[model samples]
Target: MSISKKTWLLIIAFFCVYVFWGSTFLWNKMAVKELPPFFLASIRFTSAGLLVFAISIATRKSLAITRKQLLNCTLAGFLFLAYGNGVFVWALKWVDTGFASLLASLQPLIILLMMRVIQRKKLQWKSMVGVTLGIIGMYLLVSQKDIISKEGMVIGILMILSCLIAWCSGSLFVAKADLPKNFFVATAYQMIAAGVILVIASLCFQEPWKSPLVWQDNTQIAIICLILFGSIAAFTSFNYLLKHVSPEKVTTSSFVNPVIAILLGWYFLEESISLQTGIAALLLLTGVYFINSRKRDKPVVVAKTKV
Candidate 1:
């Protein structure tokens, strides 16, 4: 059967988001060793945001917006980037990359609960089942002997959970808010706002300059990769995918990211992948599949406009 061009585009967009975002955990791990977490995030987002903003202007993309839209974007930036990603970076100091990814994958479940509570959306049975499976999987993943002995594991887990919750809240808020019709412009605003907030926070809380500027060759390479692929490519593709796909489909990134993170951890960091981690991965993947596999009676259409 021949798929429509829109379908093909959607598929490609999804592939970009899934694969690029999945590898972000590895890049982040590499960056945090040499760069202070918030400082690194601030730099990554600021660089990407400026690049995209310049492109938008050059291309004559609509940067004009109402005060309400600006406010919404700013709030989302604080929630999603400053707090969500900021907490994620902080958590990595203690959590293994695989474990951090697994914990972060709980965003979908958090989104479900948030929707039910705030929007009065009814809870679906599949979501409940997915949440249960995910929780079980997290238990299996974190209870490993090697991971449990870490001094700050509990704090890391809490921070990661907070990250997931903050991200979900930001996502839901953005979904409901009146924002730019152009995804790229909206994303640029969000990133810029986030970068500003994160930079300020980093300067005040982290005092990143006081830390030795020792950049190992590997760390420098990792920083470059993180800024390019993790910040610019991954996030831009993600926002692009959202323009073409359903929110449910977009959430699949969370599911894919964990599996990629686990594999990368094994390959790059020489982290041990126990049977429990494998089982947890399987359960999480299964849950995500079931959650996203529901049939859509209507075809999704994409506008031919460029962001």
Candidate 2:
């Protein structure tokens, strides 16, 4: 039997989240090389948010939202994008792109733990094993002598971990929070709210902003890709998938992202993958698999957004 149109759309959406979202690490790394993290993130989100709005209008979707929804959107934006993403990108200043993606692969583990705490749910056998492996993998990844010896490495790792917490918190919020009926409009609201806050934060931090015209060509191109593909297309696809598929299935991106990121970093940036990193990746990704693959008493539907 031939696939339906909906099937095709789902396939396309999955491809966007898998490939485009994974490539965001490289794009963010390139942009952050010359621009302050807040500045880069602010511009990227604001521009992408506006573009999303434009798309909404072109498609004749209503933009109206309740006051409560707007507030929820703002909070989600700050948690997911402003602090979660901005600081993560900042950490990239001191961390390798591939290494950072591998760190991000731990998000599933973090989210599972968050569920245990917030929902007061007991961990299953698989979840417990997964958490144990995740801890061991994290230690192995960060405790590497060559990685830890680098200046600012410890700080970078800490910041990324903090960002993971923020992101996991946002994921939990978005699952049950009231927001716009239209996912695109909701995303636009979140992106714009995040962009505005990032702008203020960038100012407060005394980050000198320069005209985009003066930015290096590669940085400019990377920013464009971030706006068009990373923030807009891939994120929309992610939201779409969460609605159409089980959250567990959508979360397979966690596994795919790091592998794609590592390969891209190696091919494009010549980043090395140490034997230690490979072992750590095996353990971490295996833990993620176990956590995601565990049998459930009921269907667990968790909504997760991207980097």
Candidate 3:
């Protein structure tokens, strides 16, 4: 590839991961307004998974995998899309897209803690401070009187917070899990497994499906956008970025995505952001920056003085 062509490709890739992924927050909120959350997510993920699998096959990518890899994909799919994303879509009925994004942005800090606690990895002071600040941000965001006043607001927020936990846990697992060597193949399998699990969960939850909602144009558009842009385009671009740029650089989308989500919510959804929300967003995003950007050369150990 020529230099100019590569530059354009890089820019387009960034846009895919940044803007498309960010816009899905609002698209998803719109989708749930017409259909049940679990049902909405199930359809979106199932379509996206099939699309990705077809693309992988078309590209002649290796689809071979071990039994353990399939099991790992199943476990990850259940944790992430089935519980994490499914509940998130449901919670959008109560929480605005911007607030949801702020809550979701807590993933980096949560992942940092997961690494420390679950993997028993030593972390730097930055991680500790970032997590503390993130918790404080969470408190401030929820402390808004309007938030607490709404019926089921606490439950909605808690569900979204649990979404953060599940998403972070899944990320950790994906980082270390034994899966297909190809990133796209592994992700395709993960989505297929997750789609099946979510659809079953939606059925068990008795999400309304035969309603007039199935014919809504806005709902259809939102689902299509989510499948095409959010899942397919973003995943492909992210994997491409991983191959071309440093992982740290690609992860900057975490910062940009929430900000885009907030702006899109305010402009498109007319979601109000209170002063407290703004301050909390600042704190939360800063904490995420610290968690992802700062690095300790090694685990710090304080030597005990001989008594």
Candidate 4:
């Protein structure tokens, strides 16, 4: 059967988000070797934010928003983009890209728990099973001998988990907050706010002047790729898919990303995946599938709108 053009576009968006986002772990690892973690993250989000904001202006997207909306966006930016991406980069300093990606894959699981606690909603059976499996997976992945040998691995893991929590919390906040009706305007403002905050943080934590300008190396290429594909393309495609498809389906990208990251890490970084990693991947993916699988209730339909 021939799919409609809109369906095809959604498919393309899904591919971009799932594949590009999965590969970001590799790029992040490469970028952090030369660039300080927070600074690299700051530059990445800032550049992407500026680019998207400029495009929004060129396209005549409205910039006007309430102070309350701006405040909500600022909170989201600090938590999700700055702290979330920041901690992921910092974790890369100690962990392999594959393992880091594996750990990051726990985001969905974290979100599930957060929802239950904050919303005071009872957990579904499937969700409980999923969370259990995910926790097991995390244990297996973190218990690796190589990971243990890495100095500061524990700290890195904690940082990455903290990042996950912050990101998830920010996501819930955005969902509940009063924001602009326009997704495009809201996203643009959030990116701009996040970029500005990251810039100030980067300046405070990292003296960019004293840091050698090493943009001429392979790491620069990685950073460029991160900014372009990971930040810009990934976010754009993700936002697009949210407009066209079910959020649950769009979120399936999370489960798919870890597998791809593991394979890519094995291929590009020569990182060896152990039996434990495979088992953990299985458990985590199984759990995620259960948690995100169709709900008995009718799915909510989000109307088509420009972002």
Candidate 5:
């Protein structure tokens, strides 16, 4: 692809991840209101995984993999979706969607540190400064929000941070791991493995079989949106970006995702954004600018650690 075409594709993918994943926070918040977190997450992951897996097979991609590949996908699935996302869904029980995403903005920072430690990569001063500003922006964003309960807020923050660590670790692993060459095939395995595990956890904890279905129109819509946009569209775009760009740059969408989530919350749920939100928005956006527009040429080449 020409540089210009690649740039436009990256831009489009970034926007998809930013908007759709941001909206997933709301989808999650709505679904959690009516169903158990693990149960809802299990359904979403399974459906999305199966859908993608079938697509891959129909498109003539190999579903067959070596044991090592399966192990890699399983480990990544556990970390990325099961622990990272499943626990995140559980955290949504106590945290608001916007607030959860604000906490998630910490991923870029976690990724920065983890890559430096695990991969022995050196960070640029400019990138470090951008990460610091993003952290400060998150603090400001959370500080101005309406406190739900001090106890619940603290619990939710801790839970989200735990998943943030797992997510960052999983992302770094994916950057280096030898999985299938086809991106969709790799993602399909991850989702399928994670989905199966989550379903088991749901049965153990939620026991949905013991209860009647509590499906509602709004909840169903949210779930469908999550499966289609959040899981299929945004996640595929995310993995695509991962293949072509730096993880740091791929995750720049985290900054934008929170901004979108806050706005959606305000529009749909009437969640208020204070003046701090506006100021924080500027800081966050500027931080992403610095991260994405770093002086490095060919950041993807430097940032990637091939296995």
Candidate 6:
């Protein structure tokens, strides 16, 4: 039997999230090589935001929202995009894209720990074990003498860690915050807010801005891919999958994205992958699996990371 139109759409949507979102690490790394990170991010998000609005209007999604919702959207945007994603792109300048992706995959572990501390929720046995494995994995990943000895490695790692915090915190906040009923509208507002703030940040940091026309060909392609596929297509697909499929199935992207990043980095960028890093990937991903598996029965608020 032939596949239904909806089934075809689902397959395409999954492809977008898996490959588009996964390859974003490489794209960001490539772009940041030629462009100032904050300035690059400002342009990417600003252009994507405008495009998202245009799409929303074409689709006739309501653009209306209360003041409180707008404020919450702004806050979410600041936490998730301005700090979380902007600094993440900046850190890419120093860190290998594969390693950066692995570190970002720790969002579930971070969120769980945050829940334990902020909500005082006792961890179940599976969760406790998952947390333990996650910690070990993180230590192994970071404790590699060869990797950490490089100039600016420590700062890159620290900045990425901070991004995780901001992203996880944003996830927690959005779970409770009053926002526009339409996710697309809220996301549009958040993107615009993040774009504006990143522009100010680029200025405050004295990051010399260059016109897109003058950017290197590869950098231009990278930025275009980030705006079109990474930000817009992947995000739209993610929301689509969440609505049509189980959340757990959609979350499988967390595992797939890093693997894709690692492979792409190795093949295209020639990024090294050591024995320790391999082991760490195994442990960390397994831990994330356990955490997610355990949470299926007794659900808690979980927010996905965009990077």
Q: Find the 10 residues in a row with the least total lDDT in model 1.
A: 298-307
Off by over 4 Å in 1: 1-12, 210-214, 243-250, 294-307
Give residue 113's error in model 4 in angstroms: 1.4
After superposing candidate 3 on the true structure, give the runs of residues whose Cα lies further than 4 Å from its correct spot.
1-3, 211-214, 296-307
TM-score of each: 0.86, 0.95, 0.91, 0.90, 0.84, 0.97
For residues 27-136, what per-residue lDDT tens digits would candidate 2 score against the true structure? Answer: 99988989999999999999999999999999999999999999999999999899999999999999998899989888878888888988987998999999999999
What are the Cα lDDT values of the candidates?
0.73, 0.89, 0.80, 0.76, 0.76, 0.90
CA lDDT for candidate 1: 0.73
Instruction: Put down candidate 5 lDDT per residue, 141-253, tens digits, no spaces.
Output: 66754654545777777888888788877776776898988878888888889889988898788555323245888888998998889989887787788889776777567
Task: In model 4, state the lDDT of residue 102.
Answer: 72
The best-first sequence of candidates by TM-score reads 6, 2, 3, 4, 1, 5
Residue 298 deviation, candidate 2, in Å?
A: 5.9
What's the residue-level lDDT of 64 in candidate 1? Answer: 96
Instruction: Estimate candidate 6's RMSD in Å.
Output: 1.2
Per residue, candidate 3 scores C-alpha lDDT tens digits across 169-232 of 7776766789888878887787888789878888898877855354588888888888898888
RMSD (CA, Å), candidate 1 to true, equals: 4.5
Give the higher-lDDT candidate: 5 or 6.
Answer: 6
Report how far off residue 12 is in candidate 3 (Å). 0.9
* lDDT-best of 3 and 4: 3
Better of 4 and 5 by TM-score: 4
How many residue pairs clash in model 4? 1
Clashing pairs in 3: none
Backbone atom clashes (below 3 Å) for every candidate: 0, 0, 0, 1, 0, 0
- 159-230: candidate 1 lDDT, tens digit per residue: 888777777777667756899998889988988999999989988885454332567776667767766676
